[model samples]
Target chain A: MHRSYYTLIASLPHLPLHFELDRTPITRPRLNERLKLLEDADRDVIDQMSAFLVWDRQPLDRNDQEVIERYDNLMRTVSNPLVRALINTRINMRTIVSAVRRRKAGGSPPVGVGQWVDHIRRNWEHPEFRLAGRYAWIRPFQNLIDEGAAREAQRLLFSVNYRTWSRMAEHYAFSFEGLILYLARWEIIDRWTSQDANAGQQRFEKLISETLGEHANLY
Target chain B: MDESLLMILGWTGIYGATALGAVGSIIGCSRAGQAACGAMLDVESGYGRLVGLSALPSSQIIYGIVVTMTLRGNPLTAQSAPGLFAVGVLCGIALLFSAAFQGACCASAIHASKNKPEVFGLSAAPAAIVEGFAVFAFIFALVVAGGIPQ
Candidate 1:
């Protein structure tokens, strides 16, 4: 029987849409404290999910081979169908985006030892990789990628994820599934907010460096 | 239809009314109470209201008790056993389901109210409606019990 975590779920702050939030609703420490209420087995599942899903927890330099290996390992060990679906969805999105990025860079479609890679290779010439019907955002996402609008592309992806998680949360309210969806939505908001801030900071640094360079030329 | 068997079933009806009702209340209250406790951790005030809402399902048990008493008002006999069994078991089943569903409604209300306290009263409308069904069953059972031959 699935255990409902009413107390734990109720303790969580309401998370607004990723674009609507300038910052995360709950801080890391408080979120962790609330998560501590999960059963030991649940906590282990969540830990595994965090390792795979949480953006900050993943190293920036992981290569395709390592990511594929991790994905395979997760798929093999994670027995929960919902968790597996979540992981698969995220990895598939990443794979599609990576394929788009590589295509834009004039690279051939990757030949790899994974279902997603094989699908991408077969559909290399198709504009939406024949997935636009299933994922309505794919064509628009591809357009944004092709335009080199990285920020908008990222926002579109985050919004898609936000909406997906929101629907899942609604369907599984007051249960462990609801909690997982809540955390997933929280991560989207957190990632979007941090990325927005980082982009602003980068622009600021770029302007300052240009101004500094002009001053050096005058000297 | 043996007279003794009829008496046994009639007694079963009498006891089942209260037992089933109590079971429903137990389940309903437990579900709603857990939600209330969870909501308490999120909010600063209105703890009383949340706790009170959680107790809404407790009414089913009271309804069960009333039906059981009414069913017990007459001595069990072959003539009235079927009537008692029909009214008592049916009413108990109705009360059981109403209370269980009402608890779910209350939990949803608690969840909504915890986020936006302004909707607290409005959010309880569904649970109130569920209680209305239980009341209907309770009243009808009492009226029907009176008609059963003494």
Candidate 2:
């Protein structure tokens, strides 16, 4: 039996079954414990997350750019096509949201931001990024951004992302790579929600219900 | 057909069916065993489900054995020997594939359930369906065996 793939996957650890992020600040010890479970292929994503913990707010400072670069590096290293496509959908959503935010501010985005977003925007229709486009909420999100609904667009982006991850978790339940990728995305969302527990709870509750539909028993 | 030839064929049918069943079991068990070992590394509890699912493919061989035994009861004769050989080999082939495919299904179930224990019962449904085909072959062979006289 060719089980090396499964063995590699089984060696990785998973998040607790009853994971909740509302009102609970992520302690360094807790974060580190989670980090220890990931393999080397996911190290850059971990580093980016650690950076984001420090630089949570918007406007993209030098350190935040470093975090983006780390995320880009992590994206490049992912071997699974579906996981890679999911990550691309996230990057596209973020870039579009950031561009909308910058446009509304009536100033140029932080140096290098416009160029990167433009590159991703141009290439999204390419064959390589075709699968990513399938799950992307770009068209409707772009309409929201165009209508000056930046806050709504941001919330909708997260909602769309939650749905994508939920779909992946269901379809790829048997795949180790798919499970790890979905969990990583979920943890990042959890950590983000922890920063503002009240609004996060309301936001995620709506999104979770929408994503899970009648199976929304994940209270 | 020669009387000696008929006797030899009757014996061949008996042994061949049993041997085929053993072959299917060996393949199925090894495949399921690999998945079980992988699942063991993933969780601290609920190992019973994984081990139990792994053993499910072994039933195909048992079905093969039953068919073989049913065919072995009749006396050697040209008319009876050929019918026994046909039923025994075809039934063994069916059981063989069923067991092997069921093993693959069980491996997938074990892999998934190890990660998310909630899906354990649901994941076993596909493997059980595969076993149904083996049961069909086992029953049909037994019924056909009854028609071949001593």
The list of candidate 1 runs beyond 4 A from truth reads: A55-61, A111-115, A198-219
TM-score of A-chain in each prediction? 0.84, 0.48
Residue pairs with backbone atoms closer than 3 Å in model 1 (clashes): A7-B38
Question: What lDDT is reached at residue B84 by model 2?
Answer: 81
- Candidate No. with top TM-score: 1
For model 2, the DockQ equals 0.22
Off by over 4 Å in 2: A1-80, A107-158, A176-190, A193-219, B1-50, B69-90, B104-126, B145-150
The per-prediction i-RMS, to one decimal, reads 1.1, 3.0
Chain B TM-score list for all models: 0.96, 0.92
Could you tell me the TM-score of chain A in candidate 2? Answer: 0.48
lDDT tens per residue, model 2, B28-117: 766776677666865788878788888898887778778777887777677788888788888888878888778778877887787778
- Model 2 residue B107 CA deviation (Å) reads 5.4
Per-model TM-score, in order, reads 0.88, 0.54
Q: Point out the worst 10-residue segment of candidate 2 chain B by lDDT.
A: B33-42
